[model samples]
Target: MTLTESVNLDNCDREPIHVPGHIQSHGALLAFDAALRLAACSDNAERMLGFALPALGADLDAPQFAAWPHVTQAIGDFAQRSHGTSGLAERSEVQVGGRVFDLILHFNGRLVVAEFEERQPADREIRPFTTLANGALGRLRLQRTIDDLLQVAVTEIRSLTGFDRVMAYRFRHDASGDIVAEDCRPDVEPFLHRRYPAGDIPAQARRLYVINTLRFIADVGAAPVPVHTAGAEPLDMSWATLRSVSPIHIEYLTNMGVAASMSVSIVIGGELWGMIACHHLTPMVVPYGKRMACDVLAQLLASNVQTLLAADHAKRIEAASSVRVQLMETFVGGDGLLAALRPHAAALCTTFAADALVASEGTETFVHGGVSAAAGAELLRWLRSSKPPEGLLAMSEQAKLPPVLSAALAPWCGILALQMDDNRHDWLVLLRPEQVETVAWGGRPEKVYKAGPHGMRLTPRGSFDVWRETVRGIAVPWSATELEIARGLQAELHRAGGARRAQVARDRDQMLAVLGHDLRNPLQTIAMASQLLARGADSATVGPRITRSSTHMARLVSDLLDLSRLQGGLGLAVEPKPADLARLVREAAQDVTLGHPGVEVAVEAPPQLQVPVDAARVRQLLDNLLGNARQHGEAGRPIVMRLEASATQVTLSVANHAPPIPPESRDRLFDAYKPASLNNSRNPGGMGLGLYIACEIARGHGGTLVYEYHEPFVVFVVTLPREARAAAAGEA
Candidate 1:
C-alpha cells in the first residue's frame, strides 16, 4: 500500500531502482528511437515540452514536432559526441511555454532520452562556469593535509550551493562512513565525527554512486511523474539527471526531515571512496551546473586522498623495515629457536608494540615481558585449541578469546600467533595490551524492525542524535608490514627446526650402521674357534667350547639384523627352543680367547645346564661379554667365567682384571655412544655396541645382562629365567 513497501527488506538489494518507471516533477523525460520518432515521454510532457508522444499505433504530424524541433538535431550531435550510451550531454538552453529550461541529452538502451528541467527566476547566472571553476580550484589547491582538504571542501561547497548543511563523508575500511568534516548554518546541529553503519549505503547503491557521480533530489514529498511508453522497452535512465529516487531512500530522507538533498561521489581507482553530501531543511534546487562543479571537486579530493594514504603506508613500511632487519640479525639457527629467542623476547615485545611474547614448543614454554605466567599459559592454551597446523592468527580484540581465559588474559587485548604443528601445539604468540577509546555513532547501529504487510521490514532509526559508546578490549591493529615480517620469522624458525630434527635422525642412523658392522669381528672369531674344536681335541674337553662359540655368533647376528634391514642388508630372526646354557658360555669364552691371543679365558661351569631359550642368542650374549673382557682386561690375566644353575634360573659371570668403572658413567654404558668403549668393549666401531647388543639379547630371552665393576675386576653377569620371553626375537 505504501511506496517504500515496494522497496522493502526482502528485495532492497535486488530492487530494480535503476529502471524506475518515472522522473521527478521538477523535470520531464522524452525518449526517441533512432528513426527520430518519440517512443516514450513523462505524464507531464504536454505541460513542460508543449507536446506529447502519440499513442503506440498513431503517427505524429509535422505540426506536433514543431513545438520542440531542436530535439532532432540535438540527439544526433549528442550521440556523436558521447561515443557510447552513457554520460549526459548538457544543452545550453531550451524554450517551452514561454519559459527557459535546461535540456540534458543521453541514450537509454536503443532510445535517445532527453530530460528537460524547468528553471526558476534567476537560475542561469548563479556564477559563470569559468569564474566558479577558477575560484573553487584555487581555494582547494591551498589545502595541505587531508583534514584541511576535507574541511575546506565542505565549507566551499556549502557556500557555493547555499545548503543548510554540507559534509565530507569518508568511508572506513569496513565500508561504513564517518562525517569527517562539516560546514552548516549555526542553527543546524553538528554531525561532525558521527559514524554511519555500512548498511546505510547498500552494495547496489555504492555501485550506482560511482556510475552517476552527481545525484540530486529537488524535493522529497512530491510524487514522481510516471513515464508512458509507446511500443518501446523500459527505458534506462541511468545517466538521466531527472531520474526518480528509490522510494525507500525518499522515506529515509523524509525521516531525516531533509526537504532536499544532493551528493557527489568521490571515486578513486574505480572504487567509491566517499561522497560530498549536502542537505537542506527546505525544498531547494542544485541546478545541474552547480551539481557538476561539486562533482569535479569530489574527484579532485579522491585523487588527493589516494596519494596521501600511499605516502603514509610507505613511511610506515620504511620505519618498520629497520626493526625486521634487527630481529633477523639475531635469529640464525646455530643456536636452537628457543635459545636464540630467549634473550631477545623483551626486545621483540617492544618491536611489535606488544606487551608480552610467549614461545612454546608443546613441551616447554618460554615467556618474557609484562604478562604473568598464568596469563601466558592461558594464551598458549587458547592458541593450542584454536590454531591449525602451520596456521596464523592476528586478532585485535580480547573478546574473541575463549570465555574461560577472557578474565585471565583480559589485560592482553590482541594476539599475533603462529602454530607449527597439527596437534594444536608449538606456537609463537605476541600479545598487546588493551587500548580504550570512545566512538560516536550517528545513531544506535542495531537493527530495528516494524510490522509491515510482509511481516517485518527493516526501518531507519528516527533520530540522528550522537550515540556515544566507550569501546574497550581493543588493540592497535597490526600493520601489513608487521604481519609480513612476522610470517617471515615464523617460516625461518620452522625451517631451521625441521632441519635440526632431520640431522639428529641421520646421526642416530649412522651410529647404528657402525654398530652393525662391528659384529663382523666377533663372527670371525667364532669361525676360528670352531675349527680348533673340530680337530678331535677330545669331545669331553672341547665340546663345551664349541657350544659357547655358537652362542656368541648368534648374538652378533641378532644385533646386526635390524641394522641390515635399515641399510638394505639381511635380517637375522630367531625361533627359540631348549638349550644348554653352561656349554654355550664355555663356547663363547673359547671364541673370545682366540680373538685375543694374549689373554687366556678360564671356564668354570657345570658340564650341562639346560633352559628354554634362543640357544644361539644366549651364546651370542656370552660372546659379547667374553670378547669385551679379553680385549680390555689386563694382559696375561685369565678372564674367568662362572656359571651356576637353580631350579628356575641360570646365572653366568664373566670377569677380568680391569680398573673399576665410575658409577656416574655406568648408566649409559649400554646405550650412549658406547661408554663400554671406555675400557671394556672399545672397538673399531663408531661406539662399541657390544655391551648394548649383549644386553638386548639377554632381554629377548627374558634374561638379564648387567655390568658389575667389582674392585680390581670389571665383571658382566647374565641371568636367564627358565623360560625365555622371546618377545624381542618374535618381532625380529
Candidate 2:
C-alpha cells in the first residue's frame, strides 16, 4: 500500500483502537466460553494471575482457582450485568493473594473476558480528597485574569499529580496550539511559549479527550501484551482506563525523553477548548481518587474562564458604543450626510484599529490615511457589485485573495467593509496594513516515510529541532467585538433614515389636500353652466354631454378628499343612527345593476336587521363594494351579498366568481392608488380608491373590512358591532 494509505489506516480517527489485539502490561486479561471453560488468555496472565497457560480448556470450578474465590464471584456478577448491556461495566477493586487489585470484566460475543491490575498502597501522608479539592479551589478563586487563572491551574495540577511538567495548552482558531503556561522542574527543558502544529494532535484524538476527560499512562516504554481471543475480531475497549496507548504516541513521548504522561481535558461551552498536559520523567501511577480530584479542578477552571471572557467582551462593546454615539451626533449636526462623516473618518477607522478609512457615495469619494485614490475607487466598485453577505466583507489574508483584487490592493492586505445604506451605493471601509512575523515550530510538520514490513509507512519525526518560518501577506485579525459594533452602527443608520422618509410623506399628503379643495370650485361652476345651457333647444345634446363629464369629475375630486383625510391623523367622519341595513344593501345592489346591465346581483338578507349606523356612510360602503365586484368579477357570473345578524354584531359578505387575486397583491389591495394589477387594461377606469374608502367608512362605525381569495371566488366582508356607541368608546 502507498504511504498515504498506510497513514490513513493508522490515523487515530480510523485506527481500530478498540480491537487492537493488545493490553497494557499493568493488567492481565482472560477469556472463557459459554460453558465457563477457559477460551484464551493474554501472554502475561500466568505471571500476573498465577494461572497455567497450557490449561486453557479447564473449567472455571477447577482446583487451580480455589484460592481466589473473590475473583470467581466478581466474574459471575459481571456476567449477569453484561447479559443485556454492551458487555461492559465499571472496574471493581478486590483483594486476592493478600494484595489489592482492580478487576474489569466484559463479554465479547459468547466469550467472557476479565482483566486484573494490581493496585499499589497509598502513602499515609496523602491528604483526603475533600481537603485537597477545597484548597485547590480556594487558590483558583484568587485569579482575576485568564492568564492568571491558567497559571494557577498548571501549578496546582502539578503539585497534586507529582509530574515533572504540567503545561496549560490552548488551541488557536486554526486548531494549532501553544503552551501558554507551564510549571516544571528546573532541570527539564522548557516547552513554554512553544507552538505545535494542528496535526500533532489529530482530530479523533481531540474528540476522545472530550469523551474521556482524563487519561493516564503509567509507563511509555513498557511492552503491550497481546489480547488473545477465539473469535476473529477483538473486543472493543474504548472506555478501558487500562487500555493500551497507541504506538505512535508512545514513540512521540519516548523521543521527548518522557517515561510516562497524563492529560486532563479543559472543556468550555460544551467543546474541547484545551488541555492540561502533564509529563513525568519516571513511571508513576495516579490513584483513582487523585484523578477524580484533578477532574473536579479542571471543571471549576472552565466555569471561571467563561465568565472572565464574557466580562472582557462587554467592556469592548461599551467602548465601541461610545465611539458610535460621537459619529452619529456629528452626522445630525452637519450640513449633509456625507459631509458629516468625512471629517470624522480618521476617528472611525481608529475605533476598529484600522490604518486607513474610505467612504464613498455616488461619484464623491473620501479617503484618509494610507490608501491611494485609485485603490479606494477600485475597492468601492468591488463592494457595490460583489454584494457580500450581511452587507459586510472582511478578509485577514492577502495571499489567498483573487489576483485581480490583490494587484490593486497591495501593501494594504486586510479589509473590513460595511455598506451604509441598502438603497444607495454608500459604504465604510477599514484597511489594515500587512503584518509579517516568524513562527517557531517544534519540528518539521511535513510527513516523513520509511521502509517497513508492509513496504512503506509513516513515522513520527525523530528530532525535536526548532524550525522557524517567516509569514507574510496577512494582517492582524479583527476581533469579534469589532464586527458586532459594525453591525450595530448599520442598524442605527437605518432607523434615522426611516424617520426622515416619514416626514417627507406627511408633507406630500398635505399638499394634495389643498390641491383637491382648490379644484372643487371650477368643477361646480362647470356643472351649473352645463345645466343652464341644456334649457336652449339648439344646444341640447352638447349641454347634456358636458354635464355627464362634469359629474364624473366631481366624484373623482370627492374621492381624493376622503382618501387624504383617512390617511392623515383625522379618520373618517360619521353620525350614527338606527337604520335597516337590509334596505341599504338592496338600494346599493340596484344601483350596481343599473350601471352594468346583464350582470346578475343576488342579495340574501333578513326581512329587518336594524343596527346603529350612519345611513349615508353605510350606503357609500355598499356602493364601493358593489362597484369593485362589477369591475373585477368574471363576466356572466352572479354576485352574492349575504347579511347575517348576531347578538353582538352584524356581518355583510360580498362574493363573486372571478380570477383569483395574485398572492403578492393581496397585502396591499386596500392601499390607495395601489391597483390589483399594474396592467391598466385589466380593470380599466379604476382609480383604485374604492376599497380604501370602504375600509375607512367601516372603521368610522367601529367595523372592519377584510378580503379573502377563495378558489373560484373573491370575497370582501364588512362587520359592524350591534352597539356602535359601546364599540367606539372601547376603541377610543
The CA lDDT at 125 in model 1 is: 71
Candidate 1 global CA lDDT score: 0.72
lDDT of 2 at 266: 87
TM per candidate comes to: 0.63, 0.58
The numbered model that scores best in TM-score is 1
lDDT of every model, 2 decimals: 0.72, 0.75
Tell me the spans in candidate 1 whose CA falls farther than 4 Å from its real position.
1-9, 12-15, 32-39, 55-70, 80-100, 106-112, 119-121, 126-130, 230-235, 333-369, 384-390, 397-400, 411-413, 418-435, 451-457, 473-732
Q: What's model 1's lDDT at 591?
A: 74
Cα lDDT tens digits for candidate 1, 547-589: 6555555644545564444223122344568887777877777
User: Ten consecutive residues with minimal summed lDDT in candidate 2?
Assistant: 1-10
